[model samples]
Target: MTTIEAPSGRTTTPDVQHIDVLVVGAGISGIGAAYHLQHEQPGRSFLLLDALDERGGTWRTHRYPGARSDSDLFTFGYGFKPWRGPSIATADEILAYLDEVIEENDLAQYIRYRHRVTAASWSSEERRYTVEVTREDTGEHLRFTTDFLWMCQGYYDHDKPFQPNWQGMDEFRGQTIHPQQWPEDLDCTGKRVVVIGSGATAATLIPAIAESAKHVTMLQRSPTFFISRPKVAELAATLRALEIPDEWTHEIMRRASFAQGEELWRMSVETPDALREFLIESMRPLLPDGFDIDKHFNPTYRPWQQRLAAVPEGDLFTALREGKASVVTDTIERFTETGIRLTSGEELEADIVVTATGFDLSLFGNVAFTVDGEPVDFTQQVTYRGIMITGVPNMAYVFGYFRASWTLRADLVSQFVCRLLTKMDEQGTPVVVPQLRPEDADMPLLDWSDPENFNPGYVMRSQHRMFKRGDREPWTHHKEYTEERDILPTADLDDGLVYRR
Candidate 1:
């Protein structure tokens, strides 16, 4: 193994280790990448590094009550792994599934936890990346050099959740909590709680805390669209009853879920009005009679404009109907001593306030990056098929779909990366970078995503910080899974990439 030299002008250390690939973030994407690397390129040396002490990234970090999968597990789970649990599974269940994948594949040996990557610098002359990492467990700094950089660190700032500063927030007497950093000792039993937000986090938290809290109120500036479905998939159950193989059942259910999601997406794009009516009408019966569905459940934007929060078994609606929880649709004027004062001059009393307001978007896990001693300003660059960035050599990141299951794209990107690695080995090329072709030099640069197509608050807030997208194939990033599923596997690797020895 080649020993990595310390940053230029520094003495080389014998302790520095070099590998063929270094996969960052031992979460869903990283774990999946490990599986593919081992299965596809068994001879390649690779390591999986995560900042956290555990494997599940989001699942491990989010400890709020009722933390669960918003998307069906059939699609969210790895394509290779057979998901036999309910379509909507709890965080514990998802983590358990991930554990199974690690154990079954013997991936634990490859993972090194508590290693947070601080900076990565690519050296074209050396044909490798020199990654600096801080060991959280010991506070010791270390380095690793790799021929390929596989970034699976997710897009959200796990350490800093986004909490809008309401007036008089500091003067409030009750404890304020953000779901991203839920206190383990926090107990809502008999406490009057007020949750602020209308997104999936608020929707999931309200129902989970309602039964224990004296009263829970979901305070939102506007409404969000929700879709309620059975927790268990009927077809999967039926197939199991018929004694079909687990692998076959998993594949069949996954395809069915994908088709259903495709139809919903198609309706949202082609017939939004009709789809909006269907979603609102479907939710009407689940809510209490005389409840202001328009004020509490309907959103001003079209369906799928942000995200359609899934309410498994209508649990959130059940809490609302049973009087365990309530929805208040109004803007907060400011924070009162006890709770919040609304623009309409109404005061809410609460013993605890939970801010489910979302989180800041983090690109490349907020790691500082440079190429050939020059800093990399991703915003000035463009993405190649949303996996590789233009001018960033030997690096690929997994930024999953917002409209569908994240793991679906994660699986696809992993497979593509493995294929690219195999081709590089065959060609004896040690470096590969994406470059804009002359024909596409005049292509109009656009936001990382089309706001009209998919504009979640997080993406909108951080769009300026992300890489740009162009108006053509091999430059665009936000393609639907149906299109990507067919396109990515056979995509021409040489279309926009430059390979070097």
Candidate 2:
């Protein structure tokens, strides 16, 4: 085994492998990073390490019935590859599409599955990051040194879904389940199920299992904004009918989707009341006549305050109209033996309960990080364009957009990282870090994100654990895709970045 001497005069063993770049998480972001690295920087050696046993990060982990993409595939799919499927695709369909990308690009060889990264430490003397990994299959520990670290592990805790504890939960005899860890053996046939929460997971699950289950009821303390649209993209369909190239169709549809997304965001900002009315009235026709839309469908928060759940073809409303599913907007007093008791003096009887609350945010895959000999405190640092953090050297993470498709931002970040790498090669520099400028010493720091802009339950719950952001550009994590698209491509690399040999 190749041994390397540690900074403390201790010898580290077990064969240390070295690479030019180490991409963490073989999911969508990581895969995209690998593709860009291979295509743009062919001379750089890179490896992808994922904790899971396979690829397709979220798609693989979420196996609930009717699990699908909330965002349209045209924008969600990679820029280089074209999405030939419907706008909103199922999890299986997404996994298949990812598989094709891997096969076409031959990226499987560079990916190491089931290798969980435990910790990462940067060495200033060597100008590299040493990442410690644990092989899940054989329980073997390994180390890899790399000049650059790309974090694509995503932002949620996969193993532990946010399970809110209600009073008398233990006393309830029904089978309790969270969508994150759905049990394959459990059958919902002819069961009366009550799902808690009004987010995307609950929106997706209720319609999916409504037909099979005897009855499904969605219980929520408050309502969320929902947008229903057809699964097929009219422009994409028209282009394909004319025998236009797949790549051309993809680009056209992607831009159209972006434009539509921009309009929605504009409506939310400029005229929120009009946008809210449009959303509510759109669902009125699909729902049963005289349904309590205001009580169940209306949200107190303004449009775009939280993410708007997209229901393809109004499937959720269809389920409600067919009497297979229903929605109850009320607070839960406690869980009962049969089901739950609401604060309104009502009881909901059920044989099963699904908590579609949310998931805990896992910043940087919950990996402990150290710079030189000092432990890095992420909450104390400010973000640099939401990619690189202050005082963290040779590391960049991909945190996608909340309003727009995630891959749109992922693609931009990948391009920027590649550009940075090219500049480093030209300057013969091995280390680069984001540092504050002298004039910016007194800059005010704020929460990771503005609640008014985007405040989901999960994000609000974990904002304290995230890195701070400044009020100015290059120091903030702006969520607008149109603005970022214009700014990121030609961003000055040396603005806040300090490069060293």
Residue 461 displacement (Å), model 1: 0.3
lDDT of 2 at 181: 93
How high a TM-score does candidate 2 get?
0.97
Reference-based TM-score of each model: 0.97, 0.97
- State the C-alpha lDDT per candidate: 0.92, 0.93
Identify the runs in model 2 with alpha carbons over 4 angstroms from their true place.
1-13
Per-residue CA lDDT of model 1 for 112-144, tens digit only, reads: 999899899999888899999877886666789
Q: For candidate 2, lDDT tens digit of each residue in 111-145? A: 99999998999999988999998778866677899
Off by over 4 Å in 1: 1-14
- Candidate 1: give the clashing pairs: none
